[model samples]
Target: MDTLTLKIIFMIGLISSSAIRLPHQQQNKQNTVTDDRKTPLETGLLLLVFFGMLALPLLYVFSPWLNFANYKLPLWANGLGVVSFAIALWLFWRSHQDLGENWSPTLQVRDGHTLITNGIYQSIRHPMYTSIFLWCIAQALLLPNWIAGFAGIIAFSIMYVIRIGNEEQMMMDQFGEEYQTYMQQTKRLIPYIF
Candidate 1:
């Protein structure tokens, strides 16, 4: 198949996969209780990050009719994209496994939960966010076309910057000394090497 055809097929697969909600860490606990403090502005911006970062690139791919004159990438660029995406997917799966029932779109403490210290959580306090960052980076590397990659990176970065502080403060308040200890032990997005 030609390049455009491959892009179209990839776009369809990407959108289909992302449409469904996936599971997270801590299988035995209930993870759905939500705090009610998110403002409409926060929710709206987050939705943009989630969907726009994910969907827009596929839209550009499948519907070249809507393409905004993207830069052409060399074959090597596509290879870089694949590798980045592979690493990102690995991190995401690890994060989900670590989170189990503790995972939710919005921040909420799970019922009868302990601070997770195993797996990816051992290296970074927020593997989920790290996954997100790497995912965006992968998109940027893969697309190399600038618009899709940069869009995903900037959108996700903004969302995390806005969301993380609030979430961290809330966790600290809830877990107190335990959370502080964890904070001291783990970096936010990178491992001890960082």
Candidate 2:
């Protein structure tokens, strides 16, 4: 792989790892506690979303039409998507770094997990998800394949819908008045415009 690719991966790994420093602490209810683990059905839905994202690129490669041979993406679209993806990755890294040990994929809180209101959090309540959502849509736009494009949109939509509910509930419980005030100031997905 190229150096740029390696650097991106390293950045992503470092951020993700740092954000998830204390998974066990997050699950300990004595913290900002909640029992919001997904139901079996929700878990299945989440798995479908995860696998769909993973499979779409592979399917595109082997697709008989070679991702719609006639529907090549414009060079500008490809360039924009690549750049958007890179930006989304950077945003994810920033959000993750800001989150630090407070991050948890599930609806659990860590000890001393103060509400973060600076950096990306100052604008949107969920910058990491925002970036991922943008990246997913950009992938579809850039790929110019009906299957890949729609799959990414649908898959991410499904994941976000489920994720936001659980996340908000937990945050509301943990941060209480503080989170409520933050929510009033910031949009869920978009910044000031939304």
Candidate 3:
């Protein structure tokens, strides 16, 4: 098929994979703690970033107003986008699987939460963040519009820079020295290369 068609297909698959995980994540939210560091500002920024990165791009994909299809990169870029998306999905799923009930959509210590250090968590303190970074890269590659293509990376970087310290502080508070030790062993987003 055409390049746009292939790009659309990859985007749809990425969205579908993300959508499928939502219900499962909601079910697990029952284990989350009432007290959380998910401040209103943080939540607002997250929503803004989500809209900019995902929603706006999806809209741009189907609409003419923001269409920059004429600026599309070589077909290999789209292929790379698909590969990045596949890796993101795998990392997202694996991180959730490894975290189990301890996983929270925000910064919170779950009831009976244990510091997870095995599986994908063994090397990356935030595999979910890594997965998201992958998504940003894929989005940049797949979307032709300048705003839609790069918004994810910009927004995600803002959120990550602002939130990671707080997240680690919360973990350290909850797990004490254990979390500190885990932090020493793991990088934030990359394995052996952060």
The most accurate candidate by TM-score is 3
Candidate 2 per-residue C-alpha lDDT over 15-68 given as tens digits, one digit per residue, 9 for 90 to 100 = 443454344344443455334465686677667766555466445544555435
User: Where does candidate 3 stray beyond 4 Å?
Assistant: 1-3, 32-34, 68-70
Which runs in model 1 stand beyond 4 Å of their true positions? 5-21, 24-34
Candidate 3 residues 35-111, lDDT tens each?
57889978987897888777778777766767654366787887888889889888988988888888887777767
lDDT of 1 by residue, 44-158 (tens): 7788886657677766665564455566667776666666666666777777767666666665665655678888898799887876777676666555445665788889888
lDDT of 1: 0.67
Residue 84 of candidate 2: its Cα lDDT? 68
All candidates: TM-score: 0.82, 0.74, 0.91
TM-score of 1: 0.82
Indicate the residue-level lDDT of 25 in model 1. 26
Task: Find the candidate with the highest lDDT and give its number.
Answer: 3
Please, what is the whole-model Cα lDDT of each candidate in the order they appear? 0.67, 0.65, 0.81
**Candidate 2, after superposition: displacement of residue 112 in Å?**
3.3
Candidate 2 weakest ten by summed lDDT: 1-10
Q: Tell me the lDDT of model 2 at 11.
A: 39
